[model samples]
Target: MSDAFSPPPSPGGEVSADQRQMALFSHLSSLSGLIIPLGNILGPLILWLVKKDTMPFVEDQAKEALNFNITLGIIGIVLTIITVVTFGIGAVLTVPLGILLGIAWLVLTIMAGLKANEGQYYRYPFALRLIK
Candidate 1:
């Protein structure tokens, strides 16, 4: 599966600092969820659309970020529905599960940003490969 996550070839041996910063921004964009619902997905989607052609690294990392955030958003909605359907009984489990998922999303996004800033590709484990 390493082949699946491998970065697209760079014509030069090293990625430039500007490319790395843009890639980092793609991952960091997810934090905008705090200000707007689904902003996490929208932020990276916009960045990817604007920069993907010019930056292979940004394309790969932005796509990964979008896929992961979308997956998490879906899971969170499912858990919320379970809580409601169960008449709040499921809240005992679902609430904490949602919190854990949020925490994981936050932590992992930060880590991905750091890796991208270093000019290394980072793939989020357990993210559904929903976007090619």
Candidate 2:
């Protein structure tokens, strides 16, 4: 394994098939949120924690997914609060906005997964990068 502090590896650069698969799964794990609450964050968090020491590629991808999902989760909470404060009035706008947010999250996540599967590094454009 390479030194952890070294610069991130290039796409398909010296990465084995196992590493690529793990990275791919790390990104796709966010889909767990579809069935389990906060699964998006939890999935990546668990994977990252388990593999961070051994798989740098998986660590990077999982951190990206975790950060992105966390940002979206916060936005969702704010949206829900707004809708509640407005007593359903905000729903008129928040509903559509929430749907759009979900769609965007899904699309971006799938894109990231595909990139990871292809041995490419993927960074979400809007992710907050909160997890370093």
Candidate 3:
């Protein structure tokens, strides 16, 4: 109700590009498979495309996360098929494999987000070279 109680305007008078890029990086890291899904269609696609030239490091990291998740999904799908064809024995194998893959992906994504926060590029292992 008082001028003194008003929140301060943004320090730069406008949101900086770095701030925006970091925000996208953070969102993609958490979203991973849930929001990213296949084809890198949503969050990953936006981060990879929109942030590229403006924020190369964050964009690359987002792309890495996207590639990793898509790879994971494909691996899971393949294993599922194998499981069905093999009459469920492969299901047990694929389940644990999938869990390990998920854990590793989570770790890599978190690391990428941390590095992105510090303004560094993080490359993921087993990531396909999808975004150029």
Candidate 4:
């Protein structure tokens, strides 16, 4: 993990303090999954939709967060189906996979949020860019 306080150059030129904070919130919003079902997806989606047109940095970060969450959701659904089909045998795989995914989501989300807060852009590894 690099310095979370360093700001990266914005694609649309200079970034404002307000834009950086909003972008940070957009990335952090994914953690809402811990309390609300699909809240991770919803949070980023709402932030992205609300800010994309106004802030380029927020738009990029929100879209990145949204795409990563969507990919994770798909993986989770597939894992659930596999567990169901195997009649609990797949729990061996699904359980660890779920744990790993959860940890990855948490860590990556925090890193992204920190980077965004610092005005830097962070791309999630292994995330499907489904939303372009």
Model 1 poorest 10 in a row by lDDT: 1-10
Q: Cα lDDT for residue 64, model 2?
A: 85
Question: What total of clashing residue pairs does each candidate reach?
Answer: 0, 0, 0, 0
Q: What is the alpha-carbon lDDT for the whole of candidate 2?
A: 0.87
lDDT of each: 0.89, 0.87, 0.61, 0.89
User: By the TM-score metric, which is better: model 2 or model 4?
Assistant: 4
By TM-score, the candidates rank as 1, 4, 2, 3
Cα lDDT for residue 128, candidate 3: 61
lDDT by residue for model 2 (27-102), tens? 8899999999888999999999999999888888899889899999989999999999999899999999999999
lDDT per residue for candidate 3 within 1-132, as digits (tens), equals 524222223333444457555744644545545654453335666666777676545555566666666666678789889999999988778889888877886677766666556544456657666655
Between 3 and 4, whose lDDT is larger?
4
Cα displacement (angstroms), candidate 2, residue 110, comes to: 0.7
Candidate 4 clashes between residue pairs 3 or more apart in a chain or in different chains: none
- Writing each residue's lDDT as its tens digit, candidate 4 over 1-132 gives 544233345576667999989989998998988899999999999999999898889998999899989999999999999999999999999999999999999999999999889888888887887876
- In lDDT terms, how accurate is model 4? 0.89
Which lDDT value does model 3 have at 115? 55
Off by over 4 Å in 2: 1-12
Worst 10 residues of 3 by lDDT: 2-11
